[model samples]
Structures are given as C-alpha cells and as structure tokens.
Target: MLLAALVATTALTACGLPRSGPNRNELLAGVEQTAGAPFAIPVDDNVARITAYEPPLTFPAAFRNAGVLGPDTINAGDTLGLTIYENVNEGLLAGQGQNFAVLDTVQVDGAGFIFVPYAGRIRAAGNTPEALRQIITAQLETQTPEPQVQVRRLAGDGATVAIMGDVGGQGVYPIERPTRTLAAMLARAGGISNEPETALVTVIRGNTEGTAWLNDLYTDPSLDIALRDGDRIVVKQDDRTYIALGATGGQSRIPFGKPVVSALDAIAQAGGLNTNLADPRGVFIMRNESPEIANALLGRNDLVGAQRIVYIIDLTQPNGMFFAREFLIRDGDTVYVTQAPYVQWQKTLSAITGPVGTAGSVNNALN
Candidate 1:
C-alpha cells in the first residue's frame, strides 16, 4: 500500500521534478508557434558533414603575388652611402688629396628621389644598388672624366614590415633577403610567442588584408607569401571558441585548442560525456549555419543569412563514432548532450522516497 501511494505521488509531481536540462524529446517537441525557432538537424548525412567543413584561413591571391623587393633595392626613406672616384686632379666631387669622395647618409625623399652634389634630383626608390651606381656615374660623366660611382645600400626606415602581437620580438623589421617572405619575416621576429596550432598571422597591406593559421604557414608553401614594404604583420591566438554544456564532464566556453576542432576532439576536450547519465543517442551540436549550407541541407533556397541548426550524433548508431570523428566543430557552436529518459524517473523516485524514509525513521524513534 505504501509503495502504491509513493508511485501515485511521484506520478502526480513528476512534472515538477528538478532536472539538469530538457531531455531530447522536450528539446525536439518544442512548438515552433512563431518565427525564428531553432532548426534541429541530425549530423548523419553527407550534406551535413560537408557543410560543417568551412573554408580555412587563406592568403588572397593579390597578397601572394605582390612580391618582395630585392635585397639591395632602394626605397623612399632609405639611406645611401655613395663614393665618387675621379682620375683627374681637378674633379667635381673628389676631395683635394683623395681621388674618391665619400658622400655618407644620402637620404631618399618621400617622393622616391635622391639629390647628389652634381647628379641633380634622381629617382632611386625603384632602382637596385648596381643600377643606381650606373645612373650616378652617367650623371657625372659630363663634369668629371670617367667618374666611377659606387652605391651601398643602408638600412633605415625603408622597405620595412611592422610585426606585432604574439611574437618573440614585436617591431619593424627590414624586408631584406633574410626576411623577404612571410615565414622568414616571422622567424626574424623571433617566431611565435604562443602555440602555433592556435596562432594566426594577419597581413594588412594598403586596402587589402589576408590571414592564415601559423601551423598552415609551415605545411603549405603557398601560404608563405612574399612580404611587401609597409605591410603590417600581426601574430595572435585564434579567438574562435565553442560552448560545451549539459551531460558533458565540463560546461564552459572552451576556446579552440587548435586551428581545427572535430566533434570527437571537442567531446574529448570537454572530458568526454557523463557515461552514467548521458543518452548516447542525444549528443547535439547547435549553431547558426550559413544560408548556403542550410539551403543545401534542407534542399531549399528561400532562407537567407544564417539559419538555426541543431545537429545530433547518436553514439548508439553503428557508424556514429566515426561520423562524430568526421564532423567538424565551428567557432561559436554549442555542444550539448541530453540525459537518458530514465534519469528523471530515478530523480523523482529518489525525491519522494528520501523524505518518506526520513519520516518513517522519526515515527519509529517516537514509538
């Protein structure tokens, strides 16, 4: 009679029983009475799997082709060391006793022109050291017989890339032979200060900007693009993250530990699911998928912008674990696991039986 009464009491109050969160049935039975309801998708199809793999970080074609300047190439704001050698005793630039005249620290102006004693204003920004030497010698041929001009390239504010953020050294580095490419420049900047798997490198040049994963920069030679003068390079950790909640071991906003995070990896990172309470059939990944992917999945095109998507992966299925391993987790996604249906029943019985047993013990003590 007591057991029957307890079961009846539990049946009456089961709706009020406290639970961690809604079960899979409640999560799906939610009525979409109005617009903007979350779409529930099962991550069990090729379309869904393909949609999960978004494009990775890339360097634009223009950035890759911009090309770096030669090691000895001159640019505006570069300092030059010029020496004019003359054979005659009476020369244009040679000192009284010396046959060669040393003109140190010749500055290139912002307009890409440099002025010599008798060579007049000449364009030096685009010319290499050897090429500029010939131009200077030609200029002094009329004033001094067979003038020999030697030009030496000097480092200054010229043709430099500003590297900042998570690097061993954050400063402006000259784009010479040692630092002409993106990888070389990053190395010259003392490598990355953070984990390479989670680090990102961004290059801002004029009106265009490009970015790539630091790890990809090493594996993919094409991503190691040429550096441009005045380019801004910043190395920083990837800000992309996702949320893990419900029956998982931990529930928090977990930052992506690497460039790519698979669903299996995400589950592992969250310390795996609570095996005692988790429903193997109710692991879900929810996010607002792109309209293109959503349309492709739903076989419709009316939807625009980002559409709500809830992806389920059932570990109970034969190929479920393999599919989870293949499904990728994107930034800002939510990974949730529903508790088994019996869990609430267990809670309800415990709730009623605990109080009943305590009251029975008090009665026995009084007797």
Candidate 2:
C-alpha cells in the first residue's frame, strides 16, 4: 500500500510540474512589444567616423603602406606620355611627347609593367602617375649618365576598384589618382540609392572590412575614408520593417531615414498597438544572432550554434525599457506581433457569421 501511495504521489508531482519555458514561437511574439524601445546611444560617436589625412602625412602605423607599389597593375593598349630628359652637358632639359624616340617613350605590355628603353621591367601596376615618374627617373640615372626620364599614365588599364550595391550606377571605377577618397568614388557612381542619412556604407579592403554610418558621415566631418585600388564600396539601405499582428493598427514597412527608433517609437509607428486587444504583459522583441553571439557559439559545441538562433526580448517587465532602448534593428529584420487566443476566436466567429449574413440579405431581396 505504501509503494502504491509513493507511485501515486510521484505521478501527481510530475503532472503538476510547471510548464517548461516558453517555446520559440512564444518568445518571438513577446519581442514584438519591445521592438522599438530606445537605448542609450554609444558615447563614442567617433566610432563611425573616418579620419582623413593628407599626402606626405604619416600613415597609420597599423595600416601597411610600405610605399612599394604592388604588381602588374599596368597593361598594354593604354596611352602613355614619355618624357626624355636630355642631359646635353649644357643643362638638364625635360621634353614631353606621345611618340618619343625609342629611348623616350616607354611602352606598357599586356602585363602592367612598363618597358622603358633603359629601365627593363619596372612594376607600375599600382603606382600613381607621379610615383611612377619618380621611379623611372631614379632608374634612368643608373644606365645613362644623368639620364632624365619622365613617365605619365595617359590610359588606365589596371588597378581598378568595382563599385556596386545600392548605387545609382554600378561599374568598375579606375583608381586614377593615388589619393582617391570614398566620397569621391561614390559621387562618380551617381551617389547612393537611398538617402545618405539612412544608408550603411562599408569599405571592404582586402580581407578586412570597415563599416561607416551614412548619417554620421553627413553630420560628422571626419568619417570619410580614402579608397585604395581593389577596394569595394557597398552601400546598404536601412531596413526598419516591423509587423503589428496583435494590438497594433496597420502593419507595414516604415519608411527609411527616421531617427533612432525605440520600442515606443515603433509602437507609435504601428498606430500605438491596439490597446483594446493587446496584452501589454505579453509584449516581446526578437533579434537574430549578432556577431558576438556567432563568436561565442563557434567557441562552444558545434551543435549549439549561435548563428542559427534568435534573441527574444520580453517587454512586459518594468525593466524592459532599458533593453528596448539598446536593442537595434538592422536591415532585413522582421518584427511579428502575435494575436491573442481570444482575438483569434473573434476572427473565426466573424468569418463564420459572414455567410449567414449574406444568406439573410438574399432572402430580404427575394421578399
């Protein structure tokens, strides 16, 4: 009898156990309440600014600017101006011409290196016109006594950076001048597709990527970075899309370029959630895995990856205001407001009554 009583007690405890934490769907719906809450903006506004420097200025020690030009960025079928400095024992004179004597005009081959009369193959691929001229001038002094050599890049056949993504015109922009800034290239590409205030512009240099907030660039004077050969500039439109399924009026995509939108702002944008049907206690916010989450998951077990998971924010709590403010929404973010169970029942009843109402109308017409 004692064994039977013990078994019965254990079964009752198991049956009475509290429900496990809410599932993914519930968590996602909860986030809708806190979707637009604002957080304290970072104090370091300079984080998004790009500091510009003039030529001959000390390059950032962290960046590699060895002044050694990279490989064959020059090619044939390109027009070049060759100037020969004739040291006539009287004085040094510089002469510029397109078709100079064999010794004067250096022809560039399919490979970017130029074949000067005396200076065999000097790599001119990534060097600026001025830099190339200096290199050739230095080389000529070795072969000829006081050999005066001048070099000019009349055609651009190498070292080009391709600009695409959210720009009016997408094409390969030649790295003509050595000191081309990101802003200049963007202008050449017909500017950004969206408003500069809301766009997110990034410069992909080799393997490293740098992000800049377009709005900051417009207001802050320091954020424009210089562009290098082979650099890629990508401009992305701000996506602030949210769904108001539960107690909000009119769900739709919010136009871009609004100020930092907080949960309160989002709710207001959604016509101040339908207070009549919304359960304030159940509001929530959801965000996809951030870079930090991805890094943490990679360090942990493989199966429990952070990249595939989403972050849920519960706004029903009083302290949720802090979280809502800090949570930022990025492009392609989706906000969904779940309908309450009672709301669903009401919808179902309305659908059921529609046919009965239609039948009644027909009978009245017949009478």
Candidate 3:
C-alpha cells in the first residue's frame, strides 16, 4: 500500500510539472500576473486591421536615385578612332591635297589622357566623343589652318561592373547601353546561380554599399534600378534562419527558402505540428517587433517599451487556418507548439503503471 501511494504521488507530480520545470501555460500565467501580459493577440479577422512585421519590400533611396541608364562617358581604357583633316597648301600634316586627312587609333591611358601628334597628351576622360573631337580641333588650329577633326569610339576597354559570386557566369560584363539596370545586367550575366529566395544581392557603388534579398528585387520593380559605373554586384546564399521548437514535427533552425515566408508555409516547412502531442489552441510564434511598430499597432504609448510579442493562433477552428495563411513569418522567428494538456497526464499515468507492474512482479517472485 505504501509503495502504491508513493507511486501515485510521483505520477501526480509528473503531471503537474514538465521535465524542464515550467510548461508554456505556467510561463504565460506568470507573465499575466506580473507584467501587463505580453502582447498576446489572436490571429483573426481583427488581425488584418493591425500592421504586422514583414520583410522589407521597398527599394532604398540610394538605389532609386542611382539615375537612369544612359550612355557612358569617356573613361580610361577606351579605344578611340580619330580622323583629322587640314588644308593641303598651308597645313602641318597636309603635305598635299586629301593626303592631309589622317586617321589615328589611340587608346586612353590610366591618366584619362589620349595622345595626338600636335596636341600632345589631351584629357579624354569625363568627356563625350564629340567633346574630345572639339578639344583636338581647338589644339590643332595653332599648327594648321582650319583643321577638322572627328572622333569615334572604336571599342570600350570593357568599362563594366563585376558580377561575381553566386551567378551562372562570373565575369566582367560591359555596360554597352545607357539604360542598363541591375536586373538587366543580372540577366546578361546568366541570372543568379541560386533560387531567388535563397540569394542575397549586394551592390557596392563607390564607397557606399547596400544589400537586398534577391526575391525582393525580383518582385519589386522599384528595386530594379540602374547600375553605376564600376558597381560591384555579388549574389550570395542566405544564412539567417528561424527555429521551430516544442511539439512541432521538426525542431530545428530552418532556413528561409524565400524572402517572405508566410506563417502557414513556415509551419509546413517545419514538418507540421506533432498531431498526438500538439495543443491546437496553444500555437505560438514568438518574435520581437520594434517599439515604434508595436506602439502603432496596439494604439498605446504605454506599451511602447514592449518589443517581445507572442502571437498566438488557435488551430482548433477552421478560421484559424485562414489567419495562419496570412500571417507573415520574419527571419529569426520562433514557432513553438505546446504539448496537449492531456498528453502530460498520459505520460504521468504510464510512469505510475510501470512501477505498479514492477511491484506486482516482485510479489509474485517472492510467492
């Protein structure tokens, strides 16, 4: 009798407390009494009215202000084709009629200068082809009377941005068109090697640099802005992930397969909740929202200090699934499904039966 009573008490204690001490219910109950309760809001029809945390979908101002794609200015490493015409009778290079017309192909050097017979080394960088022609003509007037000059760009020195990293083709692509955009260039370089959701597109323009998810860039037209000269574009795999814990089918840090992962998809990716052990009414997604957004959503300044939010979803009702589909899951989010209250009791009952069965076996052995 004493052994049976002791086993029963132990079983009841096991039902009351979890292995790690407190269960989700106890933690939430304590939170309610001490603090004004975490921002526990149910995912429902009213949820649509509130602004929830979501991935950034808009392009940065630095990208939008990157200017439209247009013709590239003369830069170093460009090959130039020059034709100079001068009067035959009194010209420097004009020994005779038509012979005065001379064609010279010169390449601009590192100092942004091109060489002409009479003009010596003239600044060519930062000037248009027409602008460079005028400069040559002005310099020739001193040596020859009424000199006419025409400048043509034979070939560019491949003045293009390097599209490296996770791309189909990692090479230097020439910026041939003025209206060349980042998206257009990526297509030329064989698009991204990884899927849009798993790629991170980083842009380095001069000293300023920024990055955006490839999925966001693909969906938002505004993010497909123009690319500047010498811009470095790199596509890398996304490493940030979120954890799925508690009674979910898979408890691990799952990588976001895409830029914007919806709550329903996140749950599915986690292998769904453990049907037998999961509590349908205790589904939760824990994350921290900025104080500003939290305040705006709750419409109260007093709770502005609260950044940690436990968004609850009760899957017992059909409408709950609808809300789950709309809920957006951010990177670093934690999806936790509590164990069913009855599951705990079942475990305790099993523990009690094991001891009773052992005691009965010992009594039979002694008899």
Candidate 4:
C-alpha cells in the first residue's frame, strides 16, 4: 500500500499537481497580497485609466539622402570604362578594360589612391565617380588644355553588408546607390521570409547596434534609416510564444501572433489562468531592458530602478481590462501568474513522487 501511494503521488506531481511547490493557486494569492487587491468598484475613479499616447517619431540619420547620392567611387579589382577627350585633337579616346592606355586604367592601390599616366597619384577613397572625374579634369588642365575626363564603374568593389536571420537570402550584397535604405537592403535579399511586419531588423554597424521595427520603417516615412557598409540585417519571427509559470491555465507555452500583445492578451494566451488556484490580484509582466518604453512605464524616475522591479498588475477587478489593453507587451516579455496557498501541500506530495513516474513501470515492479 505504501509503495502504491508513493508511486501515485509521484505520478500526480509529474503531471502537475495543484499543490506542488507554488502551484497556480497559491502563487496568485501571494501576488494579490503583494501587489494590492484590484479595485472593487467596476468603475473606480481612483484607478488610473491607461491613456493611449502616440510613440514619438524616431528617425535615424542614415536615410536622409536616399536617392540624392549617386554611385560610390570605384575601387581596385573593379572593372571600369574610361574615356579621355583630348581637346587639341578633338578626337574621343576610349578604353574598354583596365589596360586602356589613353585614360591610364590602372588598379587602385591599397592606399585607396589611383595612379594615372599624366594625373600621377590621386586620392579616390570616399569620392564618388563624378567627384573623382572633376579632380582628374582639374589636374589635366595643368597639362592638357580644356581636357574632359569620364569614368564609369563597371563592377562594384567587395564592400557590402550581410543580411541574415529570417530573410529570404542570407549573404553579403554589394552596396548600390539606390539600395542604401534598410528596406531596400531587405528587398534585395528577397524580402523577409516570415512575419514581414513583426520581423525584427537589427543593424549591426561595427560595434554600434540598433533595432527597429520593419513594419514601422515601411509604413512610417519618418523611421526609414540609411544603411551603411558592413551593416548586418537580422530578421526574426518569434510570435506565438509566451512564458507561463505558477497559477495559469495549461501551464504550457502559448502561441500568439499579432501586431501588438497586451497583458490581457498574454493571460488569454496562457489559457486565462487556473481560476481554481490563481490569485486574480497577483499578475506581473517582466520585460527586458528597453530604453524606448521605460520612460512611459515608470515616469521620469531612475530607469535603472524601474528596470529591476517587475511591472505588477492587479486583475481581481473588472476595471483592469482597460489598463491591460493600454499596457503594450514587448518582445521577450515574461508573464507570471501566482497561485493560492492551499495548493502548496499538493506540490509537496508531487515533488516526492514526480521522479518515480518518469522511471517507468519496471522501476515500480522492482520496488
């Protein structure tokens, strides 16, 4: 009889007994006591109504001149078409490849400067093709009268940014003039593979990293940012995922995918809590460090302090519905539902027997 009882207890624990540790019920009650009971009146004036505030527009400096700038300057190993018009002879001298003698089609050196027959060594790094032409023309004027120089970049240098993660194509792409925007880069990579709107695009430029909403950049004209060389774009699809612990329904991961998720949405995703064991008043949402939303949640207080405390929400009363809707859930948010006190005994019994259930019938037979 003792062995049978022990085995039954273990099996119950493994299957999630109501009394094991801080099950759904006891945790919820403790939460209510800690975070104050929800307002009793259906429309309590004391309860603060969550107001919807428009998020301020954040613009990145990169996208200012999207189409304004022409193609970038040519680099070494890149093929080019050069034409030199000698005013004295009134004849057009053109070269197809780098061996063109009239225009001196020599490769750009490691120092980022190119050497022409009569132009000597001139700096071409960071200068556009047009800019380089003007420099060469000015230099030629010192030797040839009214000289005209034209430089066309046929191939691009290896300088490119890599787009990875949930994008359609994951590889390095050459930086084109019109393709400097984040959206443009994403399009070149064959667009987003999944969750185009919910995709998280991270720009990793050297050591500086910034994350922006891909949908916002597409819809909101103000948020478009210009991409730079060596930028890493990562798109991720992570919706339909929620964290559940303590006193919640199903005690399993819930999948939800929407433009925005609220505290209520999270609760609903977690099966709306185990009413039998949950403490309605003790609901909390834990969010990772995000400077953008920190100011609105904790006011102007020290962000470091506000970041440490989990945002507590009392759902015992009905008025919490409005507040829950106003509270926006960000990525990687953790929702914890507390349980009641009586469920603790059930947890103790389950803990003692949970392992036995996993060991199988052979172990029970041996015992």
lDDT of 4: 0.63
Q: Write candidate 4's Cα lDDT for 1-367 as tens digits.
A: 9989877766666466444244344434554563533211112222223222335334345443433324665654544555667666433233443222354345666566877667778877667789888998888778767777888776675347888899888999877776767788789899888877567777777776666677888777655666655677777864546676667776666555766677788888778878677777767665454443354443544444324335566676666677666665655666777676545545666577466577777687899
What C-alpha lDDT, on a 0 to 100 scale, does residue 306 get in candidate 4?
24
Which stretches in model 2 have alpha-carbon errors above 4 Å? 1-79, 85-112, 125-145, 177-179, 219-223, 252-260, 286-367
Q: Indicate which candidate wins on TM-score.
A: 1
Off by over 4 Å in 3: 1-24, 35-39, 47-55, 65-72, 93-105, 109-117, 120-123, 210-222, 303-306, 359-367
Return the lDDT, model 2, position 307: 40
- lDDT of candidates 1 onward, in order: 0.86, 0.54, 0.76, 0.63
Per-residue lDDT of 137-216 in model 2, one digit per residue for the tens? Answer: 78767655665555665666445668878899998887555425666678888888876776877777778766666666
Q: Of the candidates numbered 2 and 3, which has the greater TM-score value? A: 3
What TM-score against the true fold does each predicted structure earn?
A: 0.94, 0.54, 0.82, 0.64
The local lDDT score (0 to 100) that residue 346 gets in candidate 3 is 76
lDDT at 102, model 1? 92
User: Comparing candidate 3 with candidate 4, which one achieves the higher lDDT?
Assistant: 3
Q: What does candidate 3's lDDT look like per residue over 203-284, in tens digits? A: 8887777787776666777788787668899889977688888887788999988766777888899899788888878778
Query: What's the ranking of the predictions by TM-score, best on top?
Result: 1, 3, 4, 2
Q: What is the per-residue lDDT of model 1 for residues 24-113, given as tens digits with 9 covering 90 to 100? A: 888877524246677776777594466766776898999876666677788888999998899898688777877889999999988889
- Superposition TM-score, candidate 1 onto the true structure: 0.94
Candidate 2 lDDT (Cα, whole model)?
A: 0.54
